[model samples]
Structures are given as C-alpha cells and as structure tokens.
Target: MLPWDAPLAGRLDRHPFTSELLRGNPLGDPHERPLWVYVPPGYDDSAERYPVIYVIQGYTGQVTMWANRTAFRPSFLETADAVFAAGAPACVVVYVDAWTAYGGSQFVDSPGTGRYHSYLCDEIVPWVDAHYRTIPERESRAISGKSSGGFGAMITPMLRPDLFGALATHAGDALYELCYLPEFGKAARALRTYDHDVFRWWDDFRSRPAFTKPGDESLLVAFGVAACFSARADGTPELPFDPVSGVVEPQVWERWLAWDPVRMAPGHAATLRDLRAVWIDAGTRDEWFLDLGATAFRDEVLQSGLPPDRLHFELFDAGHAAVDYRYPLALKWLAERLAR
Candidate 1:
C-alpha cells in the first residue's frame, strides 16, 4: 500500500449545512457543520439515481476524519470509492457531522446535546435528497457507523423506519452492563482528586490540553453520554452513578439502559422485520465487549422476524481501532441489497 492519497473513481462533494434544529444548542456548538457526499463513478455520465448510505462517526469523530490517512492505509474515502470502481455496486455516500463540546452527541436528540437526531433525519436527509440524484424512499436509504456511530446506526432505523430501511454497525455500543458499568469505578477513582465531582473534573479538563490527564476518556464518555441519555430537563448531564462511591443510581442508570440497542430491539421488532438488510460485525476482542453486544443484537434482529437471508453477521479477528477496511465491505454489501 502506497503511503499517499489515492485518486477516487467517484466524486466527493463537501457542503456547509446549516441546521435550524441545532440552533441555540445547549453547548453552543456550531449549527453549520461540514457535510461530505460521495457520488459513485459514472454518476456524471448518466442521469441514473443511486442508493445512498449515510455515515456517522464514533466518539470524538467529525466529518473530516474520513479523509485522515494513517501510517500506510488509505482513508475510508479512497477505499469506499474503490468498492464501486471494482464493480461491487454504485452508491452515494454521505458523511455527517454531529460533534459537540463534550466530544460527541451520541446522535440522539437531547436537551444537553441538541436535536441532532432531528437534524440528521429531518434536515440532512431531505437536503441530500433534494441536492443529489438519490432514491428518496426508505428502501433505497441506509446508515452506517462505528462505536457511537454504530449505536446511531442501530437506533436510527428503529426510531425512524420511514427514513432508513437498512443499517451497518461495527462494534456498535450496546449491552450497558458489559460495555459501560466497569468504567464507573475507574471514573470514580479518578474523580477523587476533584472532591468526587465530575463537574470539577470537567472544569479541570477544560483548563488543560485534552487527554493530558488520566481517566479523561472514561470521564468524557460518562459525562458526554449522560448529556445524551440522562440529562435533566433543564439540560445538565446527570451522572448515572455516584462519582465518589461509584454506586449505580437506579433511576438514571435505567434511563441509560433504555437506550441500549439490546433492550431496544424487542420493542422495535416490527420495524426490524421490515428492514431490507442489516449488517452487524465486531472485533472478537473489542475493548468495550461490543462483540457480545453484536451477538445480542443479531439475535434480536433474528428474533424480530427479519429473514435470515437479509442479515449479515460476523466477528472478525481484530479489535476496535483500525477497522476502516470493514467499512467498504459493508458498503458493498448494502449497495447490492438496497433498492436499485
């Protein structure tokens, strides 16, 4: 693999999208965000409309990271472009931005974060359909992402089946007990320096360079997800556990559990049954134990009455990071399955 940027057979168009839904958000994040849309090869020569796959990012992920070139591997954009160039199938890929001051919005509409879910489904989807030669029906549309983006991918279709009929999740967050609970103790130990207060840690975190201190990631995830899942009506992120004692707060923790895809799947069985395709995969040694989450979710999808043939499930021999190669595989899989 060459350590340089490669040319794409398709075209990537970048736009500045202004979200009225995000205006005056709680954290004062930008309402106008960067949006990248990729039209597959031959898009310019033909008037053919294509299926679309919307891509989101994990925690702390923004739109531009799609272009980030690591040591030797080409970015996801180059690899994704190659998927169609290799004649898998053609698609229009959209890269969405849902960043927040606390690192990520978890792609949910919350008082603490803003109407990001609405911004995606209501604003971005319509805007893309209007500006691109895309098949606007739900059967022709899909969403994909990793980690928090994976969580978004799983839930969005369940919540808004009218807009998305398929999804691909890579180590998507789920199974709260395994994926999140252990961090509570670590965060508690880290917060002792700040008098067992996460807000104090937040204040100190802002005062220094990011991740310069220990437990920054754990605390950030805790606080950021609280903002997304358990914020008070007035918009303050309420921690699900006591920072000092590391004790689970049943009510608040239950709120977080309600968003778990494993728990959510049974309720959205009818929607799952209607999906055209679903791709679920994770690393065998995922640090978050999302591999187990993937298994649980896949079982839920099957139990929901979705045809086995319509689903793709796998656990690869890898971990959470450096899974860009997996993106194109799912993209190709979804492109073939989407309404053409």
Candidate 2:
C-alpha cells in the first residue's frame, strides 16, 4: 500500500503531463485526428535532463485518465515521489490517449486508424525529445499501461526499436488469444440485438459485461457503436474472414494480424535486442488479462537470447481495473532502471 503520509502530495506538478494535439499521424489522411498528453510537474523547470515514460491509456481512457482531477494523482504519487527523488530525478511521465471516440485503436498502424504507430513513434517521441529536456535516447525511456494500453506498451518498443528501451505493462490484453478466438463475439451480438435505442445497449453492456472496456473512454465508444457490430449472434462474422468483409466493414482479422504485436514480435530480433528492460505484470485473478500470455512474452524475449533479467514477469493477486493498485509498482520498477 502507498504510504499516505508520504510527502508526494505536494510533489507532483501542480498540473500534470500537458496535452498536445498531433494531427495527421503520418496517415496521409486529412481526417487523421489529434491525440492528447499530460507532461509531469517539473518538465518545464529542468534542463538537467530526464528519462521518459510513455504511459498509455486504455481504450476506455483519455489522456486525463490517470491524472484525473479526482482520485488518482495523490493516490499514486505519495509513494512514487520518494522512490523517484531518492534515485535519479523522477522521469518525465507521458500519458498518450490511444484513440479518439472509437472503442478500437488496437495501437496498430492500420490503413484504418491512419498509422497511429508512426504518429506516436515518429512524430510524438521526437517532438517530446526536442521540446523537453529528455535523455533523447531509447535506453532512458520506458512505456507502460494497463489492458489495451498495456498491450500497447509491451509491444510498442518491440515494434519501434529506436524509440523506447524499456516497457512495463499491467493487466494488458493477451491479444494473441482475443483477436484470433474472441469469446465475446456473441455477447457483442446479444447486446446489439436489443437495437439502436440510445441507452439500452449501454445499460445492458454494463449490467453484465462479457468484456470490460479496454480502458476509460473505450466503453463509451463501444457502447455508442453497438448498432454496427459486424459479427452475427452466434460469433460468426456477418461477412466472413476470407473476404475480410462484414456488413459494417469492421477492420478484419487478417489485417489485424499483420499488425498484432504478438504475431509481429517474433520477427523483430534486432529491435528486441535493443531492449534494456522488458517487464510485464498482471493480476492472478484478472480473467480478462492473462498472465500466461505475458509470461510467454517474457519467455519469447529469453528464447530470442535477450538477457533473462531483461524480461521481468510478476503476477499479483487482484483483478482488472486495478490501476489504483498496480501502477505505482510500475513507477518503482521503471525508476529503478531508467533513473540511472
């Protein structure tokens, strides 16, 4: 538990990681939108340099999710500040909202989502480094998040070798399991069968969620898109995977696999080699986020011949949506390495 008596309450930036809108994420599409961020407290005052943490928010979350005006900042920082202060200066924390109002940004560089991968790695990282007092190298940077955001964090550095050196994910989706054989397809149909009434789907979805929102803002977007679920009532695609066509034209599994981190990772040997630390954690009771997949990911790193210690895996006793509980540990582990 975080020591509430710790002095971090007053230690964080009076504000938080600030928001910046990076439009047209190398998508070559004008409709490409802007994503936001929250820079930590001391970013403006220091030229001495800092490591960076690209902490992503889940599908249901926005950039403001962790540093919410309500219950989180004080909750996390009370212990974290001491950890950071006692070591190197606390690194810069970045909160990148993965998507706009849609429930699915799988963090993939889709022709659909306009190459968000390039936007985050190519445009945003460099922008942050040039504008901020950063170590300006991948080894001093980290990425972390929960659920979908967790998946994003774990895979981003592997995918973007030159960008981040370390990653810490908590309760992230085992995408290898869900994307190929999603158990919740029928649930999507069951809720949508109730039809386009404004509040009906949302009420039902919350009443008995087969799958929780990937993060903060995602649920709202998912609920809003209930009328267009391209899958049928029995877990079959309304169109089919072969043609990659569906009634509503949802992004297909094949295109998704091309970008799925789990599938794409096996080939990134050079990038995987660049990792300074590769750590992932999830709750033992988190049925939605699997410990096995993350553990397998760690093993994948080892089998690739990256140092064994480069991959750290832990299973905590908890369930999903435990950010209030899991993230401080991430900060501690992250500081232990990047703060050097």
Give me the candidate number with maximum lDDT.
1
List model 1 lDDT by residue over 233-294, tens digit each: 99999999998899999999999999999999999999999999999999999998999999
* Global lDDT scores for all candidate models: 0.96, 0.57
Clashes of 1: 0
Per-model clash counts, in order, read 0, 12
Summarize candidate 2's per-residue lDDT along 32-109 as a digit string, tens digits. 333333344455665578788887766656654454433433544444454555553467665565554335455655
**Candidate 1 residue runs with Cα over 4 Å from true position:** none
Among residues 3 or more apart in sequence or in different chains, the pairs in candidate 1 whose N, CA or C atoms overlap within 3 Å are none
Q: Which window of 10 residues has the lowest lDDT sum in candidate 1?
A: 1-10
